[model samples]
Target: MDDTLTSTLELAADWADRFAELTTDERRQLALWLEESPENAAAFARMRRLMSDTALIDAFDKGDAPVQPLAPLPELRAGSSRPARADRRKPMLGRRQAIAAGLAGALALPFAGYWLAGGQTAGSPPPLRFASRVGERRRFTLPDGSGLLLDAASRVAVDFSEGRRHVLLEQGAARFDVRHDPARPFKVRTPHAGMVALGTSFSVDHLAEASELRVFSGRVRLDVADQETRVVPADRWALVHGATVSTGSFDPTTHPDWQSDWLDADAMPLGFAVQRLARYSAAPVRIADPKLASLTFSGRFRLDNPRQSLELIGALFGLRLEKRKDALYLA
Candidate 1:
């Protein structure tokens, strides 16, 4: 191997060692490093795969014991499409094969970058887009010291220029912890409403036909498309739909706690709860009985595992759950 490739592999190994302990700044630096070259990304992927192995993890957890490296990866000739059928069955990994696997991992990084940065290229300029898939949440910092938390199945497009920082919430939900910047106001634009904040912490949920805004701290000005502008203070929320804007009270004790990975619902409709849960659920949850959709549910549910949460909800409501190949039906 060349000196550059060897150095990159060593760096990848170091990152794998500290992957779980890396701070936000360290993660940013790692992202920047991956952006430097395709080789670096490939090397990081190879090391990450190795670190994620069940045997390696178990060994690490068992204490300071040296782990026996598993068999090396399969080999492929230069300009080959893929390994032959016989080679695919082989489990051994040679030194050259290991290096090639690292390169393969690097080649996959660009596709993985979509989920990491909402489709935005790391260390790239704006007009960037970001998205989170089902059963996933992402937290990242903006160039302006602002922090953003994207809920599952959420998407947003960002544009930051000389004078303003603008974001369009395309779908799902997101929380913004804005940094104080008097010169450039932070604005979030939804389908039917717009929000402007000077320095505040707020969350926006833009689901089908409805957009809800909740202010956790500081204040925000809500501008509905055809309604009067309203100032929402801390502990308040506004719901916008079509041409109507309704202001309501916000009780943190009962609202969905995204920060804690819990959904604390108080008399929330079953349909709405299912809708929210669907974002984080791998399988589609369907209500077989239309009337049951209006039933209200109140409780705190974990968001990390949607299937378990659904089972709990089913038990609470005494609802029957039918499992099929494609979806879960509740009645």
Candidate 2:
């Protein structure tokens, strides 16, 4: 019943808000704090469990129960800066006793959100695992009889269940050829948008943490949380970020080309293309002049021979290509 226990719980809640935003230094400090006392770590773990349990409750109440490839509790919800309501005048219960009391309601496990030490608590949602890297294209048949093509440096996770087909694109771009399932719709989650498909083929590109969804065929209802929903017609695209959604017509053919094994680009920045092409080479590639990074290029090159391509590109641009320690240098 000491006041110290109460302060520890309050501090744990404060740290939950920061887990996502903390800089490396702050995170290091947190590590030190946790290491300083076993009690501190225990309290933090309890707070995290509570946060997650609350999220599950919220998700269920809202009827958004996550399906397929169940995710660990999502990273703490955004804008959850509100403090836990507590009676300021109430006496602090013993740490062990308080946690014990919260444990008795087994049916409320999802709602209680408390767990013993060493159990899972909400953490960074694992970045969607991908089978491809930057500038590389990959194709895989999904479990739901659909097709998936992952673009360069893209990451995504798929979950096919009895009720829904959910895909989370952690980063970069991907094209989905979703099979028709009127009873169970296909959904794709990006940081900035949620796209629901009504039996269709579409591609979604998430750039710089922004979202752009393009439907090649069929229809997609794009929702930007709490914002107006938008219907993206076939062959058109919707660009969404934060709470804004802008619709425009774009050729799906022009999106990132994963069909090409080599580098396939259309008006990609010269510097970025160089960076990507560098991956195929034995040595690292460097641009000697900062100004060279500003140049843009559009073309497809076989990545198998990065050195040869570098030489060709260098000749075209009147630049020099230097190879050193597994890198190409554009001087």
Candidate 3:
């Protein structure tokens, strides 16, 4: 019931939101947090459990929180491999008890997804994980007939159950061509503030703490954490750089396709273009400083040769692009 524990719980909740789409640097940071103290690890574990326990929802729906022993989760509506299980059965801190432990404010935070979970709270489908090689791009067809185009070095997980279709872009970028299903909203999740598509065609690119979203076919309802959700008109793009939000319009029909060698960007960040070029490299490509992103690139460039493309980008910004130990760096 101390203030420290409560704050840690809140922090853990935010961390939980990003767990599905952590970048390499984020994973390292999480490891460091877990290593800070046993309490930190325990708090994170409880939040993770809270995310999957539908019994907690049942308790919340009723007038009281769960006070009983850990109960089994209902079978995933259908197409799930097996029933869900809960392991923390004992005298436990239910939501009410958690509130008593000074967690009321944390629960009230602007984490709508934490509460709704895209209608998959009752059951979780067996995850189907997919990843592309550093220089390879791949396409997939979901059970729901939607199409997923993963960019080079990207990874994502798909879950298709009776009521919902969820895609977790763990790292890298992907284009989603979703089939319209009102009953089952097609959503893409990331730890960042935005992402989650519905009946539309769009692409999401993630690097470090920023995310970029480009909509091609349908309008997208954009969510900026702790802010109101805004409607992004079709043929527009949105950017979340730290606390700043930038958006602009583009010719959706002329949007750059990674499949093609050249990408025509109109005032896109230098980091984003480099990230795409790095994907085609034989080794890892990284940016030395986030400040370098301040310089923007606004033209077409050949992507087939990553080395040459990287040099061109570096030269334009007056920064050096170098290779160190088989990894490429642009500063």
Candidate 4:
């Protein structure tokens, strides 16, 4: 990396590290800094993007020594207009500003930018990680010709060892289309569940509440210890939430194609899909009624158009839509 880019990254890291506690003056200074150039703003965005990566965060947490206690969060005043962050998804260990900045510096420049798009070192090795940024999707093919279609803001770590092909879903969602090699088993895992492909294509989502698996073709076996291993075939789905496993079947034809840019909500929670759509919006999109978040909605909604999607959702739910200066609220 050049000197100018390096300097800009350093500045961006400083701001990102202290984002949760920026004073009014600091906020003004940051605005001034961002207004200085477009590159500066982009650099800051990249910083936050990397900060949100769960794999990079895993690496950061592992590298941290003599762990420190986290400070308690300040209470939100009653009747505050700002919505609290969703408990289902959040950047892990994001408060360790010092460690965050230091580790970010220690890692190679453009950690998210270069690595997620297939940057290689002197010798391309195992445990390669690929991630997509917020509101963006990415596709990758391995050396063995296996295809990976990564969902928006998703992260995955791949380890192609001599014995097995392993992929860990650190965060978000991903679809794996395996290149059949009976000699080598293909495994996909999240923090909660594990799967061994039966030479098939399947998708895994690491949501805040649970890990979901939807199989489109062939089969996948849930192969976790002490649990009854079950085979999930085409049009079948499975969910793992805190050691509890649930199974359901759906019509493959009616199920929205995962490859499309639109969201196929098959009885999905409103909050979850809203969280996904919020990435496309600049202002925070919040639900006025907390109870509505858990309401399930099954339909097709376009991802590219957040405004239209919100309007449709509001109409369906019989909620009022109000666009405020601070946020877009569905009441």
Question: lDDT winner among the candidates?
Answer: 4
lDDT per residue as tens, model 4, 144-163: 57899888777898777456
Model 3 alpha-carbon drift over 4 Å, by segment: 1-123, 196-198, 288-291
Q: For candidate 1, list the clashing residue pairs, or say none.
A: 42-106, 72-92, 72-93, 73-93, 118-129, 118-130, 118-131
Give the winner by TM-score: 3 or 4.
Answer: 3
Model 3 C-alpha lDDT per residue in residues 176-293, reported as the tens digit of each score: 8888888887777777755656568988877667787888878777778877788776688888877777898877665555656666667767877877787788887878887887
Q: State how far residue 219 of model 3 sits from its true place (Å).
A: 1.8
| Local error of candidate 1 at residue 308 (angstroms) | 3.4
Q: What would the C-alpha RMSD of candidate 4 be, to one decimal place?
A: 17.2
Between candidates 1 and 2, name the one with more favorable TM-score. Answer: 1
Residue 278 lDDT, candidate 1, scale 0-100 = 85
lDDT for position 322 in model 3: 83
User: What's the ranking of the predictions by TM-score, best on top?
Assistant: 3, 1, 4, 2
Deviation from native of the Cα of residue 21 in model 4, angstroms: 47
Which tens-of-lDDT digit does each residue in 282-321 have in candidate 1?
8888888878877888898988877787788888889877
Could you tell me every candidate's TM-score relative to the true structure? 0.59, 0.45, 0.59, 0.57
Residue-level error in angstroms, candidate 3, position 328 = 2.5
lDDT of 2: 0.61
RMSD after CA superposition, every candidate: 11.7, 17.1, 15.7, 17.2
Comparing 1 and 2 by lDDT, which wins?
1
Q: Judge candidate 4 against the unseen true structure and give its global Cα lDDT, from 0 to 1.
A: 0.71
